[model samples]
Target chain A: MSGADVLLLALGAVAVGAGALVVTTRHLVRAGLHLVVCLGAIAGLYLVLGAELVAWVQVLIYVGAVVILLLFAVMLTRAPIGPADDLDRAAWPAALVGAGSGLGLAALFVSAYGWRAVEVAEPGTAGLMGDRIFGSWVLPFEVVSVLLLAALIGAIVVSRPDIGAKDAKERAR
Target chain B: MIRPVVPFVVAALLFGLGVYGVLRRRNAVLVLMAVELMLNAVNIVLVTADTTVRAAVRDAGLTHTGGVFALFVVVIAAAEVGVGLAVILQLYRLRDTVVVDDLDLDAEPEGAR
Candidate 1:
């Protein structure tokens, strides 16, 4: 086993461990923090896999933006930072299903591959990624941008009430 | 050389853990967090596939398609989360609570308000 392989395994462990903590922890804030750790470790795994662009973008988008947004939502809702008695329900069923599927899938993958070595190519560079996105995948890229815009507008519409309605109610009073 | 199966299995487990959280957690925000974990798991699988395919094909253009697919998934996931959190915020405003059990899809009587 090379040093790089060892590093990859270690990072994978960190990511999986942190991910487990993200779900199991009682404190909401701590769960979010553990998510950060898991995401960071995933980014590290990406780095080890030689996808530098994906790794950095993972950090920037997942770590920098999404998580902060989550924290903001948590604070805005004023949810209990600590664990609540009723936060979890019917844990045994969920555990059985989750673990069973997880292990089942793992076993399937391991058995299928059977300790075979997969070739590791050069990490996809930004240049190559850009070419592909702009070249062959341009339409999907544009559609995603449009989707993001629609989501933004939809969020604003759903979260805010109509000013005219409020004004009319005030005038009636 | 790393065994591609390793990362793939880990991702599968992550997805499972995500499923567990989504089903067990009553808090809307925690459910969303669990969804994020699932998305991350998908990303790992996609990128790992890209690496393996790239190594086999030796064609730079064809191999990175997995990466591109993963990229789009990330973008969509971000948008989904944005809209989701907004909806959750609105729910909190209406009910003063974010527990999933408290939400009702059925219509109340006109005079209930």
Candidate 2:
């Protein structure tokens, strides 16, 4: 009914639409791009929720860096890009049932526990989030940093592309 | 009327789409995109929660504790993306195909199971 509601709705539509494209599309590269749009919409919703820090970080980490790396991998390894029906067969039934039930359960819980409440917080700044992250959430902070380190190492190991080839040549030698 | 619910509605649709993509797609990049879609859907829910709830999480001058907890979540997402992509890349190298169907890592000898 109000302006804020209208904005939230529009942004929400964007998130869902982009998300659908991320799935239904056939191309691997295009799907990654769609993911960026979907994530950017989530950041917008975060802004509307008054979580500016989370929104930007969502863009920076998920949209900016993560998607780029994914695209690069697709390009480097020559992943299959055909439309010949290359769907996953083994876990299809299980995944559909699990995800569907999970979604249903989430809807029930959210409506029951969260729908009626009025939020107290508004959009926050990087400084505000920074203070909290370093102050009280220090343990998780350390863990994530370590995680980033692990990911970086993993990226180097996996995406190197030359490692396995080099090993083959070494074995031939 | 149905305005505030728009974000939630859209996010649900997106979540469903992500599920389909994750299940149907074979490319690792597309699979990662599906995961991103799911994350975005959750982010929508997170934002909705942040807005609908009454808290001082946003206002630093009040209580900065809860906001810090939220920051932990964001940072964790970042770490997840970084690590997950790297691992996917490695899998591609070993297996040559991102499609889950081709992954016969344990395809040999029925008794091996």
| Clash count for each candidate, listed in order shown | 0, 7
Clashing pairs in 2: A50-A122, A50-A123, A118-B52, A119-B52, A119-B53, A120-B53, A120-B54
**Residue A123 of candidate 2: its Cα lDDT?**
52
Chain A alone, model 1, TM-score? 0.90
TM-score (second chain) of model 1 = 0.90
Worst 10 residues of 2 chain B by lDDT: B104-113
Stretches of candidate 1 exceeding 4 Å from the true structure: A163-173, B107-113
> Candidate 2, residues A60-115: lDDT per residue as tens digits?
87778777877887787786566435645455664585468447745865575553
Tell me the interface RMSD of every candidate, in Å. 1.4, 4.5
The TM-score measured for candidate 2 stands at 0.77
lDDT of 1 at B37: 93
TM-score of 1: 0.93
